[model samples]
Target: MLLKEIKDIFYKELGDIYPKEEVNSFFYACIEHYLKLERFILAIQPGLTLTKEEEQPLFEALSQLKLEKPLQYILGTAHFMDLELSVNENVLIPRPETEELVQWILADCQEKKQFKLDAERSRSVISTPLNDRSLQILDIGTGSGCIAIALAKHLPNAKVFALDVSEKALKVAQKNAESNKVDVTLLKHDILDPELDPGLDFDIIVSNPPYVRELEKEEIKKNVKDFEPSTALFVSDEDPLLFYKAIMDFSKRHLKENGRLYFEINQYLGKETEALFKAHNFSEIELRKDIFGNDRMLKAIKK
Candidate 1:
């Protein structure tokens, strides 16, 4: 089967599952992965044909696609900040919105340096070396380790730690750290629990913990509810904000004074998250939008 022929058959089987545009996009991605061809090359060489050897794997991969498995899981890697991360059912896939949280943190750092006018003056004011030196970050529920691994790669001087309750998740995180060739500490710990690792402090604490309400399950896509880890996606209806409360309380003891807290929040609970953080005396709490302009990220500073 030629590459063009594969595209025709692929859409015939699954085009109704996706829109015309999405089907096209998936066709390009599947061909790119199978052929290992650059997008520009693929474009320039439109007449290029696939040998039967290449077509065999293409059909196999496309079969998975027809099943509606996530493309990241199909590709065996996801691009986060240009770094490829291995993703599987054992870990939650990294979302683009969480990438925004990382950019927001970097922007805040740059803004602070400009506001102080003397980076040295800003450096002199803090007790910990994190303020004077580089940030040390801790990510609770690191999932696929995208947050910690991206930070470790992007922030040259900072040390990043990825923590998760599931040993299976940590194993994925550690593998991502290794594959990225970035040094990130992968630890097995439940952030919701009070007695975790004796209060070692961090300059920045971030998480995308479970915030989905049980009632909202009907609205979520079946792939999400059926495939993603339920423990990493859900909270009790009795306490929809349980993870937020626990994470914030944990941050109070684990974050250095003035250190920041970031969360990828459930949109419906934005106001509730804001009030919860405020009651905990967290300063400068602000809700920011996801790519879709939905309330998604919350930032706070420890007093």
Candidate 2:
């Protein structure tokens, strides 16, 4: 069948399901992934045709889309911070809001130069030449290791570690670390556990944990609600601050003196999340907004 004909059918079938621009973008992505052709090629080659074999998966993908399955899951990959990451049902697809969170962390770290150890060896400050010390960063509830891997890539003098409750999510996160060519330690730790060990001290502890209140599920998109892992997305409405509380408790024991703690919080509870940090005796607390101006990120210091 001709490429234009199939493209027309794709739009007709999905236009009701998604916005016009999104459907158009997805159509091009599908062509590029399946046919190995650039989007402009479709425009230039008006008579472009697809063989029956080549069209098979395109139709299959369309069927999945009709079911509201996320395109990232259908493609088996997602791009975060311009790094292509392998994703599946076991992991939540990385989002732009989280990317903003990463940018915030990177900006803050870059603004300061500390008496850190050299990258060549893990030696003391005296023994190793004073360079950008490898700051220790721990990402709690790292579903796909996006934040951890991005930090390792951007912060050359930082050792990044990630913790998650799900072993399956850790597997995906590990693959992403390898793909990104960054060294990130992955650990299976349930931060919510009352007896959870607050392991080694860290210069920074950041988490984009399960902050979505259960009552807010209805506000989520069908794609996210139907496809993404609920464990990585939600908290009990009665106790919406569950993960933030646990992380605060963990930071108390694990964060170094004057160390920083960061969180991507629910917009509705920004003041409440900030209050938790204050209650925990965290100083220099700052609440910031994302591109949309929603209260989306929080930063605090262990004083």
* Candidate 2 residue lDDT tens string, 79-141: 998799999999899999999999988877755533332333456445434223558999999
The models' CA-based lDDT, in order, is 0.81, 0.88
What does the lDDT read for residue 294 in candidate 2? Answer: 98
Tens-place lDDT digits, model 1, residues 1-303: 556677788889878787788777777787678777665654576677878888887688778777777777777777887788888888777889889988887777667756655645656564332332467789988999988888877776677888899998888888888988988887887777778764478889999999999999999876677767899999888899888888888877788999999889999988988999898888989999888989999999999
In angstroms, give how far residue 93 of model 1 lies from its true place: 1.6
**Residue 99 CA displacement from its true place in model 1, Å:** 0.8
TM-score per model over all chains:
0.90, 0.93
Candidate 2 Cα deviation (angstroms), residue 268? 0.3
User: What's the lDDT for candidate 2?
Assistant: 0.88
Error of 1 at 52 (Å): 3.6
